[model samples]
Target: MPYVPPPDLATLSLPEIAALVAARKLPPVEQWQPQAVSDSLMVIKADGRWFHDGGEIRRPAMVRTFASLLWRDQAGQHWLVTPFEKQAIAVEDAAFIATDVSEQDGALAFRLNTDEIVLAGPDNPLTARGDAETPALYLLVRHGVEARINRSTWLQLVELAGDDLCLTSQGARFSLVPSA
Candidate 1:
């Protein structure tokens, strides 16, 4: 018999399929952007058990979820999860926007707008939406992503505080204090 694709496959595109398997289909961690349509990176196992759906692995997650796995978090905060290494980035977490990695002197270099970097602090304070105060856009790491920062991907990590916030994140790590 000829193999048939699932009915929903008709509504998807190759890029869409790739996004579900990896990349921007899911929202970044620590940011409260609107939810996406699909949030899954399928992993097909070697065993024949998971022929179509893949093998023993992380189940399909809803794209709208903040926890990366589930949309709702018990902590009452939205967070993003990475399947690559089972890592999670809090909704309040932030990173700078970086261009595609380019090779420099045989090394990979990352670049970002000085203004495009900011922390997603607890709430909107001095800056407005699309404002410089927004948490630095995070890098959507691939499931199998691993690199040594060949060219030292420069980043200015900013800490998120309340409406009146303080920032940090280069060589120092600090804890977040929640609002009561």
Candidate 2:
């Protein structure tokens, strides 16, 4: 069946967005304990582009499949794992990009580059990094993997934030900018 992207987040309620997030069944990469570690020669650029060797991975399906298999180790290394083997992949910034965001009820919903929906809350909290002059926002995806909020999405989040520059979702509060 052809892939049908989820409807606009503005039209979906919090329950509906949560349902969309729950529907995506990602691979259990953490369960795979493959000892064979090798380099995958793949690099995820800061702009959310995936490149293998020297060529860009153009197929969206292929990228999504690989993304499903991604796992980040405790050492902050990115890997593509299977039951048989695990391969290291370089990441310039983050594994995924939060291409869009929406406010629903009292929660924040983010749409990743892989078309995955992530609802910000306690389990998947928002974090701010970088220096005070240049703040970067990240959303915990799964198993230590994070999606960096892109420029446009960051702007949207800023607009959604309160005058104190804080955004609250699911009882969790996050600062839009890094505190000095």
Candidate 3:
């Protein structure tokens, strides 16, 4: 069967987005305790480019598949996990990039570079880093992995934010401006 992308966020209500989020199945990387740990020689750049052994992984589907297997440990190390082994991967800034964003039923929805849709909520809250002068925003994708909000998406979020430069979704509030 051909791949069918999720419906546009603009047409989906908050409940529908939640249902979509719940219906998606991801690899059980967290449950795997692979004794074999090695380097995958994979790098995810801050700009969201994926490379392997110095060659760019240009296929979106391949990237998405790899991304589904990603797991970030408590020490902030990234790894591609499987039931048999775990391979480390370098992440320059964030594991994924938020390429687009939209608002629906008072909730914010984000589209990642891998074409995955994420909703900002208690389980996937938004965070800010750096100083107020150069703030960087991120959204928790899954299993401790985050997606850096790109410049264009950040601008769109800012436009949707209140005068206090804060955005709220699913009862969780985030300040876009970093603290001093």
lDDT of each: 0.28, 0.93, 0.92
Q: Write the per-residue lDDT of candidate 2 for residues 1-180, one digit (tens) a residue.
A: 787888888889999998888888888787789989999999999999999998999999999999999999899999999999999999999999999999988999999999889999999999999876789999999988999999999999989998888999999999988877
Candidate 3 TM-score over all chains jointly? 0.95
Best by lDDT: 2
Residue 56, candidate 2: Cα error in Å is 0.5
Indicate whether candidate 2 or candidate 3 has the larger lDDT.
2
Regions of candidate 2 where Cα sits further than 4 Å from its true position: none
> Would you estimate the TM-scores of all the predictions?
0.17, 0.96, 0.95
lDDT per residue as tens, model 1, 1-180: 442222232254444433433432444433444334342333212121111233332322221132233232455332234433232232222222243233222222222221111112222111212334332223323222211111122232121233444333222222222223
Question: What lDDT is obtained when candidate 2 is compared to the true structure?
Answer: 0.93
State the weakest 10-residue window (summed lDDT) of model 1. Answer: 115-124
- Model 2, residue 157: distance off in Å is 1.0
Q: What is the lDDT of candidate 1?
A: 0.28
Ranked candidates (lDDT, high to low) = 2, 3, 1
113, model 2: CA deviation in Å? Answer: 0.9
lDDT for 121 in candidate 2 is: 90
TM-score of 2: 0.96
Over the stretch 45-146, how does candidate 3's per-residue lDDT look in tens digits?
999999999999998889989999999989999999999999999999999999888898768999898879999988899999999889999999987899
